[model samples]
Target chain A: MGSDRSARYPDGGDTGTDRAPRDGGGRADTGVGRRGFLRAGVLAAAGLAFGRPLLGESAADVVRMVGARGPDDEMTDAVREVLKAKFGDRRIQTGHVQLDIPTDAPDGRAVPTILDIDLPITPNSYVATYHLLVDHNPDIYLAAYHLTAGSGEGPIETRIKMRRTGYVRAIAEMNTGELWSAAVKVFVGLNGCG
Target chain B: MPSMHHDSSRDAPTLTFTMPAGAPSSVGEAKILLPLSVARDAVIDVRALLVHPMDTGFFRDAEGNPIPAYFVNAVTVTYGGEQVARFEWTSGISRDPFVRFPLRASREAQVQVVWKDNKGGVYQQAVDVKFA
Candidate 1:
């Protein structure tokens, strides 16, 4: 679950650059104070131009900083939990599974996504199941698909609703005891979690 | 010709199956396309389109009343009477859901798909698989 905090406060400190003196120097009686104030002013200007929030930090800030860093942590944990419950402690590797989602989605309500397993579908070694998950949604598990000898070799395309900007993941389990996964970060302009 | 009947009432849930071209068919709002056969050790593609409002119950009406939640709860696919895949869905799933997946072609068997909605309605479809 990526947050706007790091992007807001790169240094992760409590110093309010906005409180700097107008002339970029606070009580220039001390040369060090003058330099510090000037630096603060410059940082404040950059933050404002970059659209970083200037308000006091909230609990969300602490949570965002302490919780899972990106979609990989949250999504991987969810997938691992499901797999562990179903197949035990099996190794899951990245690759072979392709997840397609727009980097920026104007409407989170109907973000079109596709999942394709690149491996050949053979009776001896084939993709048997797929799990789609979303980090930061009310329900992390979005949907699951099971493929059999009756299914074709085409990519699965569908529209999924996201609660907010987060990571989306796809995991495929092969019949030969191999699990492949893929994920993508999506920026949602309009929240659709509801 | 098999006629499709649309019924919104919760008491009667409709279920129908349609095979590829040249088979006895019933036209319904929902359709699942499955290949008739595939070469041995080949991959088989399965696709399905289901009809449902998938109302999230979050939106409000003109009078400001919230709509009740109604959507598909579960979908499962089976091959030769063996479980293949199962999906648990939420309101996040798109309206009139369309799903696709792949399977390893092995032998001649029957593929079955079943979906159950929140309103206690169960729908099912099936097709035969021929391996070359």
Candidate 2:
């Protein structure tokens, strides 16, 4: 549908900030809910070395954007750093809960795709939100589709951005308040519609 | 997903989409495969993959500041005068978004995908699948 960030998939691709702090357990400290994921505003203070529990008041103050460069550039680095600091020790299993993306986008804009939460989900264990990420996208945390009993019924769908070529990831947040993720790399052939 | 959405004017706007070669289909696998290319009327299978940035435009800028969020607002797909799928979602979308689904296979139907940006820009694609 698109060439640039919205090329392949109509909604674009994954791209989120890798800011915030790491948990003592050494796993990437991601917000399982509205609580802690990096808001696009936190990139400014991210280098200040804020403590764990990213969304808290002490970690940052919502910084107003001052320029045209989108935070998409820092996403992969920030996410990877935090993930290593927070989840370096866990052995993540590759399953339907996670999704991989292909490179060589025909369009950078919307890329069509589906993420299946194949993990058995019950009322107490259903996935709350499916976290989507892309390494080379503008940001590492592409998008987190928040869901509940009404939306979490199955594989969620949407379009995201892709600045260039990179890897895409899918993470599922369980009702128990834990995070699980899977990722795949992409080899882009050219800039989308650029 | 691609097609024509004609207004009262009668000449509908067309749609289009494209993807890189050999990109991975699923995350962690590191590679996407594409072999499902069937004829429009053959009733076969279809598989496709695409890259996405989906920036919320809410992140900070070079000076450590929050940038405005920018994202896609709509998506439409069609094959042979029939609407196959459509999506209207916000940013918060993941990277390298991979979509694998089934459809009533065809070749001449003309597959097109279109995305409308938050700022009112439109990006589209139209592919004539001739998998005879």
Candidate 3:
């Protein structure tokens, strides 16, 4: 199962090529050539049928759906429900936050993971809260951390139990009414959610 | 079960900040392990270790005394001047938590982290981004 997913994503190498701009320019461009545009249009239309975001949506908009509403048993939906109750109508972007976990975990009893917030601390704006979530677990919501200006400066590291192969997400809320998030997919051989 | 008494002597929460040694000089006591690649996507992978006991206040000590709950309450991350990520932590987290995340970066930017404990102790650290 792990190998299957790995084949689909193919490490980070394939992601580079897939995201590379067709134009030979140093800047990162989201535009495409005429042929590529037509292909994207077709894909976008199909995406609509599958409830996926269209090409018109920004990357941030697409990324925000990482933990959007899903099945009641889904971890993403559980986290999304909590977030909606906490912060209504606030937009969460995909930057300045990282959720690190192995692509595959042979032992789901304890999977080493990390949630790092790389944004600098400022008097005017700073991180105020953190939400760590795991999908497919009996308890989708894993942990929550609240930080102030006096909290330590370092990433929060720990081991998490996974019931099955799923994604882990870390969401951070700032004092300035902004939220950031990051997620990673992991495949677990043993079920730990029991 | 141990006694449910609180010790007045060890009531204060210990606070410290550290970063990885070597390249990417750090400012102040806080340091971050950021391996930034200058790629077209420019996705920066960030890893940092936080020092905290994450005491749940549920277990009893050797003498059956209840340990006071002392955990990092919250953490926030910001890039440049824009708010990025924030975390609200609970006692379920383990001790000495390690956090890792990725941020989209194209140029040198300032990253900051602020964490607060249950006892109102706040610690803040800042680092500058460097590409390898």
Kindly report which residue stretches of model 2 are placed more than 4 angstroms away from their true locations once superposed. Answer: A1-76, A82-100, A190-194, B1-132
- What DockQ would you assign to candidate 1? 0.27
lDDT of 3: 0.58
- Estimated TM-score per prediction? 0.60, 0.37, 0.42
- Provide the overall lDDT of each model, using Cα atoms, as 2-decimal numbers: 0.65, 0.47, 0.58
* Model 1, span A8-91: residue lDDT tens: 444434344454455555455545575677687777777655333324546675454334233123334454465567556566
Higher-ranked by TM-score: 1 or 2: 1
Error of 3 at B44 (Å): 22
User: By TM-score, how accurate is candidate 2?
Assistant: 0.37
Q: By DockQ, who's the top model here?
A: 1
For model 3 the local lDDT of residue A13 reads 20
The candidates' interface RMSDs, in order, read 11.8, 13.3, 13.7
The candidate maximizing TM-score is 1
Give the residue spans of candidate 1 off by over 4 A. Answer: A1-30, A33-95, A118-128, A146-155, A173-180, B1-28, B35-41, B130-132
User: To one decimal, what is the Cα RMSD in angstroms of model 2 from the true structure?
Assistant: 19.8
Cα error, candidate 1, residue A38 (Å): 6.9
Q: Residue-wise lDDT of candidate 2 within A1-194, one digit each (tens)? A: 01122232233222222333444123345433443333423542553444222233232222311112121222234565645654564443334464534445565555655677667755466666666666554445555545444234455544555545555677676767666655555544433212
Candidate 3, residues A26-145: lDDT per residue as tens digits? 233655566776676665555445442334346764555445321111234355576567566577666688776788897665588766678876556656666777755555677765
Better of 2 and 3 by TM-score: 3
